[model samples]
Target: MKILITGGAGFIGSHFAVKMLKEQHEIAIIDNLHPYYSVDRKKQHLEVIKEAGDFQFYQTNLLDRDETINIIKEISPEAIVHLAALPGVAYSILRPLEYIDYDVKATVNVLEGAGMAGVKQVIFASSSSVYGMMKNVPFREEMAAGKPISPYAASKYAAESFCHVYGHLYGMNVKILRFFTVYGPWGRPDMAIANFIKKLKNNEEITIFGQGGSRDYTYVGDIVNGMGLALKNLKQSAIINIGSGRPISMDQLLDELRVYYPDMKIRTEKNRAGDVDRTWADISLARELLDYEPEVDFSKGIAETVAWAEQHEDFL
Candidate 1:
């Protein structure tokens, strides 16, 4: 299969690209290399992807509708894994409009381009944030995601609506995967695990928010595996969650970190805006539909992530 992965130089995108390349699939990546974090880091990711296998890399921003459409038409990929977006819930609170511009508009442009090119399938990466503070413990796909607390979540939900619209109009198969709290090697620096490690390494105090809220911390490998399965078996449009189905509290996360940082310091603060009390994904739908099961244990994943971060000190 010829696959076009947008934002293929980012953390999860790079992992997925490597997986596809190794599977002998022809891959093309579209990335703006936006300095949301570090262009140098993204370049490093591209280098790693190159080492995995040969692939076409297009430095195109999805925000440019004309260019995005033209590139898709030129590639004419059988499938598109749309992963480009400005990610960060807290950051979204500060600049909500940026989410509309980068997350919502970019996704619309991708769908538009895919529709124009008659692409067969589109796999959109949504977030657990869309669930908001549901009364239920484990969030299900059937649950209404109408009250997104953050602009980032709202934008993702809005983009998902566009996906269904495009799917209905163009007869394209769309798979929306709402990923849980994803963490792993080559992880984003802004994420909690990475932030804790960075702060600990620098002898700085790490702050715990909102009585140590829990999250279904899914590993990137599992998330990528779920996506691969979705690509193969999903014959129609669906909204499914790709998560570990195991919720880990912040205190538990810190305890895991203590194994690495015995002398790490900590403090407490109120929950930040746009933050949820907990996120637990009911991945039974994924299990039933795609035979998806998370393989990496949380402790093992954290050990590997910490080890990787230690080697790549510059990544922090």
Candidate 2:
């Protein structure tokens, strides 16, 4: 199948692109190569995908309607995986309008373009942060996500709503997957796991927010696999959680890191606003709908990520 993946040079999207390419699917990637992190990292991801010899890439932004529409018309892809967005809770707090412009408006453009191009399916990248501070142990898809504490979460929720509208009004098959705290190779450096690992490797103090708050740290490989399954099993518009069905505290994660690197240090700090105290996903719906199950356990995934960081010590 020929597919278009937006933000395919970023962390999770890049991993998904590689996985899909290995499955012999033709891929066209669209990424602006934003300066959120090192552009060099994005270039490296592109190089890895180029080795596959069947992937095409476009350096563009979804906000430019003409460019995005033209690319879609030319590629005539059967499906789209929309992953491009300004994605950071703290960053959203600092720059709310940027978040709204990129996450919300860009999504609207994508949906409209896809509809005009007669695309069959779309898989959206949502976030567990949309659940806010739920009292439940594992968040369910049917639960209310109306109380988004941050601009980032609000934009994602708005994007999901746009997808739903497109699905209902135009009969588009849409799947909205809410990802938990995903980590692993090619992970975003701004995320907790990657930042902590980088700090530890450099013998710097890793900051702990809210005295070791817990999170459902899903691995990137597991997320990409589940996304592929969701794309394959799309029947109607749906919202699902993609996560390891368990939560791990920051203290526990730090201790595990110590086992790998005994000299690791931690510094406690207050939790930022709009940050959830904890997140655990109820993945039963995903299992039933997409046959999705997280394969890489937290400890194993962290170890693998640490090994990768060690090998690329200069980047740390």
Candidate 3:
């Protein structure tokens, strides 16, 4: 399959690129390399992707509808894996307009462009944040995601809506996969895993929010595997959760860090607005549809992340 990935230079995007390439798929990526973090990190991710396999790349933005549509037409790919967006809950609170605009409007451009180009499948990179503050333990696909606590979540929900509309009106096969907390190598400094590791490595105080909370931290490799399955097996249009399905608390995560840094410093703070106490994924739908079974356990994944961070100490 020939595929176009919108944010191919980022963490999960790069991992997915390698996975798809190994599966004998040709890839073309579009990314502006927005400075949410150091562009160097994205460059490093590109280096890894290039080392893994052959692929084309475009330094462009989907917000520029003409450019995005033209590139889509030029590529004429069978699938468009839309993963690019301004992500971060706290960050979104500070810059809601910028984040929401990129998340919602840019997604509109991608969906429109894909529709115009007659793309067979559109795989959306949705988020677990859309299930904000749910009382349930494991969030299911049928659960209502209408009450998002953050602009970022709202924006993603809107993007998912656009995807559904495209599927309904244009007869495109849309696969909406709501990703949980994705972390691993090539991750950005904004993410908890990377930031905490960097802080611990530097002997800086790591801040904890509200006795801390649990999150379903899905490994990037696992997410890539599920995403690849979604790409290959989009029957019509569906929304599914691609996650680790194992929720671990922040204190528990810190305990895992203690395996490496035995005496890591930490401070507790009030929970930030729009933050959820926990996130657990009911991945039964993904398992049923995509045959997706997460391979990497949290302990192993955290250790691997620490190893990668140590390997690239200068970057952190």
Q: Which candidate gets the maximum lDDT versus the true structure?
A: 1
Ranking by TM-score: 1, 3, 2
Q: Write the per-residue lDDT of candidate 1 for residues 1-316, one digit (tens) a residue.
A: 9999999999999999999999999999999998989899999999999999999989988989999999999999999999999999999999999999999999999999999999999999999999998889789998845899999999999989999999998999999999998999999988898888989988899998879789999999999999999999888899999999989998899999999999988899988988989999999999999999999999999999999988999877
What does each candidate score in C-alpha RMSD? 0.8, 1.0, 1.0
TM-score of every candidate relative to the true structure: 0.99, 0.98, 0.98
Q: What is the lDDT of candidate 2?
A: 0.88
Q: How high is the lDDT of residue 89 in model 2?
A: 97
Better of 1 and 2 by TM-score: 1
lDDT of 3 at 295: 98
- Point out where model 3 deviates above 4 Å: none
Task: Residues 240-286, candidate 2: write the lDDT tens digits.
Answer: 99999999987788888888779877777888898988999999999
lDDT minimum window of 10 residues, candidate 3: 228-237
Considering lDDT, which of the candidate structures 2 and 3 is the better prediction for this target?
Answer: 3
Clashes of each: 0, 0, 0
Higher-scoring candidate on TM-score, 1 or 3: 1
